[model samples]
Target: MVTTGDAAPDFTAPLANGDIEAFTLSDRLDDEAPVVLAFFPGAFTSVCTSEMCAFQDRLAAFNDLDATVYGVSRDSPFTLNEFREQNDLEFGLLSDYNKEVTDDYGIAMDFADLGVHGVSKRSVFVVDGDGRIAYSWVSDDPGVEPDYDEIEAAVEDLS
Candidate 1:
């Protein structure tokens, strides 16, 4: 798993940002803005919904910190499209459909106990302008969400 001070692994994934375009992680980091990558288990679930909407609610603060926020999940770009539209999510969601990105970050989970598999574990990574991880949060229990204020503080410190 990537941790604070480690260089975040770069990958190119298709975005669910309504345009369904490809976004290269390294390319975005070139802008010298901290990127907040929120990895959720699934779309439309209650907890995931609240967590994503919270980000949406705090979008201004993220913008004020000159950070870019993007939700990442194993869900397909198609599902994310509906979720984004339903929640009025302004930020994009990266589709890790193949689970390669999730696995590389060491956040992939086997949810067979819940009749699901190959889902992303709830986690967050703050990659600074230099493409090094500034903060990392991984939840053992998927029900738990990261502390938004702490994430904001991390970004605030980058300034």
Candidate 2:
């Protein structure tokens, strides 16, 4: 898996806002702005909703740190649109339907035995300016929440 101080891989995907957009780590990390790339197992799931809503509630804090928050999942763009609207999300929710971005970021999980789709494990990566991953957290279980305090501290440190 990619670790701290490593250049974050760049990719393009469809955004929930109905735009086929391309995003790169460097673009987000430019201008000394930090990026919070949060990967969820899937859309419309309990844990995923909680995680995203928590981010929404704390959007001001993240903005104060000059961080761009992006919620990523293997769901399709159409599903992402519904999720964003239903939750009233203000930030970008990216659709990694092909799993290429997830695989490139080394977050994809295999749950064939349980009949689960190959999806990204719940994880968070903080990329600093210059596209270096400054912080990363991967949930041991797909069901657990990430350490938000640690992520906040990481963004604070960048500031």
Candidate 3:
């Protein structure tokens, strides 16, 4: 996975916002808001749900820190669309079906044991406007969640 101070890899992926449009990582960073790019393994799973919802729950705080959240998964946009609605997720859930984005970010993992291939590792990256990763946390265990406070403080420190 990407590490702090590394240049964040750029890619576009289908959005789960029902618009049939793609989300470009660099574009979000250009908005002058630090981008909180989160890569979860899949949608609709218990651990994934809690992770996404935790971001949703603290979205306002992230916004307050001048950050925007985006959750990436290997699931299709169709699947993520429903997952977002079902969980009341207000942020965008990106579709990295081919795992290109995940791979570019160096977070792709072989989960053959779990019956999933090329799934993304549960990772979080805080990218500043310059496209540099200000903070990064990649969990080796799917059940582990990143420290939300540290993520928030990292972005807040960007100013």
Candidate 4:
């Protein structure tokens, strides 16, 4: 898996912020702000919803640290937009519908019991201005959540 000090793999995916738009990770890197990529298996699920809402609750803290945060999932842009609206998420949600980004990041997983496959694991990667990952967290258990305090500290360090 990608870890601290490793260069983050840049990707372009459909980003939903009440609208569908192309989001390029490298483009966001130009401003020298830390980028938080929170990967979840799917949108609108209980755990995913809680995780996204938690991030939304702490969004101002991330913004104060000049961090750009995005929630990623295999859901389509349409589903993501509706999820954002329902959750009142302030940050953008990226649609990794093809699962390329999730696979590239080495966080892809399967829900074999449900006959679902190629979804993202619950993970979080904090990339600093240098495009290097500053913090990494991955959980095989979908119910688990990342340490929000740790992520905030990671972004603060980058600033």
Candidate 5:
């Protein structure tokens, strides 16, 4: 699994923020801004909804620190777009439909009982401007959410 100090794996994925657009992680890094990649299992689920809404609530704090936040999942852009609108999420949602990005980050998991596979394990990574991971959090229990205060502190450190 990617940990703090490791180079964040860069990837280009479809971003859903009302509209689907191409997004390249390196482009954001080039701006010398910290980026928060919050990976959730799926969109619209109870736990995922709460976690994302929590991020939405903390969006202003992250912005104050000049950190860009994005939610990542294997959900399709259409579903993600709806999810964002439904939750009033201001951050863009990345569609890892192929699950490649999830695997690259080493946080992929399976839900045999639900017949789901290759979904992202709830994880959060703060990537500094240099493209190195500044903080990392992973949870096997999808119900758990990252500590917003800790994440804000990590981004503040970058500033």
Candidate 6:
């Protein structure tokens, strides 16, 4: 997996808003702005919803730090759209449905227990303007959420 001070792997994927577009780590971290990339196991799960809702609730603070937040998962665009609307998420929820980005970041899980395929582990990465990973956190258990405080602190340092 990509580590701190290493260049963040860049990829382009479709967004949940039916926009057939793409975004890269460099594109997001332009102009000295930081990018908060959160990866969840799936959409519509209880823990994922709660984690995203918490980010939505704290949107202002993240903006105050000049950070762009992105929630990524292996969920399809359709599912991502529903998840965004249902949770009132203010940030972009990227559809890594193909697992291209997930695999590039080395976060894809084996799914030994669930018989699922192409699922991303719950993880987060904070990339600085230079496209280097400033901070990262991955949940030991896929069901757990990331440490928002630590993420916020990392963003603050960059700001």
Local accuracy of candidate 5 as per-residue lDDT tens digits, 68-96: 99999999999999999989999999999
Better of 1 and 6 by TM-score: 1
Candidate 1 per-residue lDDT, tens place, 36-109, comes to: 99999999999999999999999999998889999999889999999999999999999999998998898888
| lDDT measured at residue 29 in model 3 versus the true structure, 0 to 100 | 77
Clashes of each: 0, 0, 0, 0, 0, 0
- Candidate 3 residue lDDT tens string, 58-131: 99999787788989999999999999999999988899998899888888787787777889999999899999
Better of 2 and 5 by TM-score: 5
lDDT of candidate 5? 0.93
**Which lDDT tens digits does candidate 2 get at residues 1-159?**
777888888777777764546665565567536989999988898999999999998888999898989999999888988899899889888889899988988888977898987699899999888777899988759889888888999999988
Candidates' RMSD to native: 0.9, 1.6, 1.1, 0.9, 0.8, 1.6
- Between candidates 2 and 3, the TM-score winner: 3
Poorest 10 consecutive residues by lDDT, candidate 3: 18-27
Summarize candidate 4's per-residue lDDT along 1-159 as a digit string, tens digits.
798889999999999988899998988897736999999998889999999999999999999988999999999999999999988898999999998899899998898999999899999999888788999999989999999999999999876
Point out the worst 10-residue segment of candidate 4 by lDDT.
Answer: 24-33
lDDT of 6 by residue, 52-152 (tens): 89888878989999898888999888889888888888788899988998899888886778789768888999988888899988775887888788889
lDDT of each: 0.93, 0.85, 0.89, 0.92, 0.93, 0.84
lDDT at 98 for candidate 4?
93
Deviation from truth (RMSD, Å), model 2 = 1.6
